[model samples]
Target: MSRENTLLSASNGGPKQSPVRSNSSDGEKSARQRSQTPKVEFETERVELKKSIKFSGALAILLGNLGGASIFIAPTTILSLTGSPGLAVLMWCVGGLVTLSIAVSVCELALLLPRAGGPYIYTLQVFGNIPGFIILWGFVIFIGFPSWALAAYTGALYMLSLVYPDCPPPESAVKLLAAWLLVGLVALNCTYTSYVTKLQGFFTMAKASAMLIIIISALTTVTSDHTQENLKHFMDNSNTDFGRLCLSVFAGYFSYGGWQIITVLMEEVQNPVKDVPRALVSAMLIAIFLFVLTNMAFYMVLTPNEALQSDAIAMTFGRRLHASLPYLLAILVTLCCIGSVNVVVMGQPRILYAAACLGHMPRLFAMLHYKFLTPWPATFTMFLGALYMLLSGTVALLINYISLYVCIMLLVLLLALLHLRYSHPDREQPFKVPIPVLIVQVILTFALISVSVYEKPHELGFCLLILASAIPVYIVFIYWSNKPRAFVHLVDSFTDFIRKLFLLELPTTYINNHR
Candidate 1:
């Protein structure tokens, strides 16, 4: 057949082109046809996270996260450093203001890019991949695991206190209890997210009620038994120095640390642009009220020296109410620790998942449970890390290592807001933090870093060392290994093993798309 005839026949589906064609024109025509064909691009399937969390659930998370065991522990540290309830209260208020300012900046970022990983997403999007990876590494190693471990540890200690009020429990028993608590919470979160949210809601209400009862009883029933000498020294500023006051502020800031966790679950929130920011502000306001009032309640019954002397200030306050009240207070403190631990476990895995999706980490961390619609692998990974930390008994060391990095992360996030302002000037920001608020936050973050470094140089150095350690990891996993296909394949096999072992059904859509 002639070349033109052959092309016409093929167009009409009459006959296929024969392989025996000899004309040079046919070869050129075939090349032209191939060049004109459009490319077919395949998109990787996305794992859909369940949006079962609502405003109330998110508020509960925020409340639970902010009212960690730190509140019970930090008051004594603040009081010891400040030496006056009045100054400590002022520091609390000031710390809340500083944190709220930073939260406002985070709110703006969360609204702009409402995804998982919270500050990691913000820093990643604004800065770039390396900086983002650093943040993620810091979170996994420093922020998430250590915080969860500490909460579990504190909860275990408080639970033991109920049984052994006179003497401390053995280290082995405490470690075992902490390990069980950490594992149980992780399993709950991995199995079902709805139950986790509901549990958080219940704990939030229970703890808030307990706190309100303490506040009311102290204000109404306590006979203002604070000594005249304590009152005379209420405004005492004799021991106050810049560094000491800064340390008190740091303690208060640590208590107020978890408010920004709302951003970590932005994807699961029903209304990210609206509810997340609202929850952030409302939760912080509620936390500040409870913190100040709880501290005031302590001062109402105990002198400054008495408050400073006790290891557990909340128990001291409760003991003054009634000798038997301390036991009840211990239970409340345990609940607070559990709630905080739950929040940490639930939120931190999302950071790993986010990083994995972005190719900053192994793909296994990004896999969601086929049935539960949760990041099971990431959650399990975090659980293992937390368990290791609990076993090692380095909770305090991990916390100190993360503290400076936390400050640096906050500073970077604020600077990220400023950077995004100019770089993506037209991006939609449903909740815009005023320039003054951002500026104030940046200044405050710098001051906090400077003060922290000046006050605790060794701690700052250790944290910096921990952060710097991420460089080698990033080089190996991302920069040098080039394509991580082997790693990804291994991860997928492990995920499949987990699914089969757990007897969970794979998602129909994922199966279809993969096939």
Candidate 2:
């Protein structure tokens, strides 16, 4: 039946109609509706739960999830660390493919578990509640949401440069401006999630096109003596420190981190089972091409030193046309980042709403905005948190924290994949990352382990928190689940007992009436 028909049929009886549910004869419902049951029955198809994601849409989600800040920052890190252009470039290629393999594994998991929490959902399912909740909040506050807000702030500052190059907004003003950006993007998400999603897809094309144009211009450089030396540096692999190059290329590899964002949106995505794998592989391929070409262009025109120095490198790239080109680059960056900013603005709140759905947060967040059909409470709270990030100029710290958060969440997901591989041996999948991919995933797990050990010692506490939430969940399940505490249950049980007693009376007393 059509969704409209079903809703209408379900609603025809008036206010209580939605809850009337199926007849006991329907059989499908008999398992759900006994008064003492623990599970709740949703009347709607919730087919959104089953729908697969599309290719373009998946790519859009992936980019919206990861595209912004990394592209701009990685090149600087690449040259600073590797110094060998060949080694640096090679790592990016290898990293992209390895990342793609990871993406493939995530897609497999998404198909198996298409829950709203994405990685959080997968984690909770495999690892249990505590780890899931910890990972959940970690992304919501510290990393996934805030980075996008900071990127928007970066855009706004770049935009303001158009008018006042001599005096870009002061530090205080930047904070205030970032706050406003955070609020504005939140407002955009408030308008409607579906609209924001469409906007993200649209903006991805624009970001890609603008980047392509700029990179093309850079690659087609007019050589001066200054440019020649930088060109020679890239081609001359002999003097490049190979060890440093391996470590140095991390910048570019890290830049590619967001491609796995598909894992986050697996639930809302239409036909995710079919679309996710395709979208992930495609986004990685496109991002790989873009990364190489953009870097080539960045190096072709400017030397390594110039790239490291410029906060707004595109401005310098534009200067090739005229001194006024920085203004245009500023405008482009501002607009594109706004698009990316909106993506995060829209993405993170779903995690919160998922929290509510799973009984962590208050249920109000689970309510769809009556008009917008988005999670109004969750989106609003996310905006407020982003505002906090903006005011504190804590973007730097937030980035550090969030990077750790993402790493932990990823580890959870990798483990989740392994769980599914063993747990559901009978299930057939349309797509599987080849066995070699599993080996790569094991290595990625080690990378995450190394990062955690070598870098963030504090993350273990968060994972411990994950373990912590489980205790309360267990307690709640034991204490309250089967026997709900409320006058409603009292009235309900009393009503059932009274009705049964009256039914016995009917058989005896109605004997006279029947005669």
Top TM-score prediction, candidate number: 1
Tell me the TM-score of model 2: 0.77
Our model 2 lands, by Cα RMSD against the true structure, at: 10.1
For model 1, what is the error of residue 510's alpha carbon versus the real structure, in angstroms, after optimal superposition? 11
> How far is 228's C-alpha from truth in model 2 (Å)?
3.3
Q: What is the TM-score of each candidate against the true structure?
A: 0.86, 0.77
Per-residue lDDT over 74-163 for candidate 1, one digit per residue giving the tens place of the 0 to 100 score: 566677777778888888888887778788787887787788788888888888878888888787787788888888989999999999
Given candidate 2, what's the lDDT at residue 216?
62
Give the clashing pairs for model 1.
none
